[model samples]
Target: MKRIILVAGATGNLGNKICKELIKRDADVKAIVRATTSLEKKETLTKMGVEVIEINLSNIDEVEAACLGVDCVISALAGLGDVVLDLQKSVLDGALKAGVPRFIPSDFCTNYNALVPGENRNFDLRRQFKTYLDGTAIKASSIFNGAFADILKYNTPILNLKDKSIGYWGEKADWKLDFTTMEDTAAFTADVALDQNAPRDLQIASFQISPNMIWTDVNTATGQEFRMQQLSNLEDFAQFIKKQRADHPAGENELYAKWQQAQYMYSMFSTQHARLDNLRYKDLDWTTSLEYIKSFVK
Candidate 1:
């Protein structure tokens, strides 16, 4: 029997990829899009044969109706705020009411379980939501996919390909940061959601290498040598967090929050708190950082 999968945030980067993967697997795919979504996006999804339903996620009734026949719910909602909490809660409620057997929350980051409370607001919000989900009857799965391969293209403080430099807080040479491409993460997520016996929590990493290894890949991919910058040492990182707290006392400033989150994430990567589940999903052909970087490298 073909499973009906309802994808929230289907118009988003990761969500759109998930929708495509679901379609490729012959699943009956439905996308719950907000009324504000662009017509062009909707048309594009329609062209891909996705059933798109426009509904305000804030309206419980509408959300519930959209989830009626869905066997599973996949959320790729962005941000780390109360709005995200409210929307996801609504989806959970709707799924519960509709008897959806599986739910995959929009937790496509590092293993937040390893981070301490009050350290990272974004991760804290996700962890709080997971705690709420645990108290419910709905079966929920969280995917911790380290860093996205696309981040290398961005000017993020973690890895800046444009600048040809990598940032670290501690012993950069010894710390191993894990990463997976957005495409691979979406594909793995679709497979997990479709599986009836997948675990409650899964971790996947296409590449787990040190900063030096990343530099090596960058050089090999682009045929150019790159440099490494130590953003913070152990003591310096602690002080950096302290200063961040001082700058954003309430932790409400989005920009400052992101900076602090990056620092905390860098620390997490250095410690290697999460276990990798890549071996379990042997069917997926994961994409490495070098392979993805080489695509655009001249």
Candidate 2:
């Protein structure tokens, strides 16, 4: 029997990569996408012979229909609105209704229990969302990648390297930050999907790199000298951003907008201290190095 896998939010950057990687491995793929989303991804998925289904993940019945006969479901839903709950509800209801065996929730950052109640609203919601999944029969889990290695392209004021300056918590020295590239994460996810007896929560870490190391490596790779500046703590960093936003609310510079996204990054940097102990995936020999990330850097 051909195993069927459904990828929700399949048009997203990471989600689409997961679909393509799964297809590369010859697994039957069903990509669940919303009508409002671009079909450019749908076309690419179609070219790869994936079944692209246009379904509103907010609609439980419709999502259930999409999951029919699906052996595994992977969700990469973005945003922090109630849409998160809606998508989860839809996936859970649909999976149970369709008898899907496995589910990988839209969790790709932070260890689930690491969040302090008041720190990050988005991470808190995801932790709660994962708990909801635990109450169901469909085996489900999440991936805790420290941060997306690709996000370095954007120059957030806090961690802006484009200006020859990088800000981080603690001392100005190097500290390891575990990063997982989209491709490595997607490939590991495919491995998880293929393993019939794998545990509910499976973690796949590509690299534990530090900002100082990243800058040094980038400088060596591109022959461009850069500097890294360390900030005291997240609260101090938040205050700096708060003052910046207050002074220039409508600044044309993109870093102001990037600051909003940095909240998640800072939260990850603060709480991603857990030892990932993913010996289960050690046999796969899945590793992503700075050499692998060279193309992703700007």
Instruction: Give me the candidate number with maximum TM-score.
Output: 1
Candidate 1's C-alpha runs over 4 A off are 248-261, 264-274
- Superposing all C-alpha atoms, what RMSD in Å does each candidate have to the true structure? 2.2, 3.8
TM-score for each predicted model, relative to the true structure: 0.91, 0.84
lDDT of 1 by residue, 175-222 (tens): 887778888899999998898888998998877877788778778877
lDDT of 2 by residue, 220-298 (tens): 6667767666667767876765565567655323322544465566665665545664566554454555575466555
Clashing pairs in 2: none
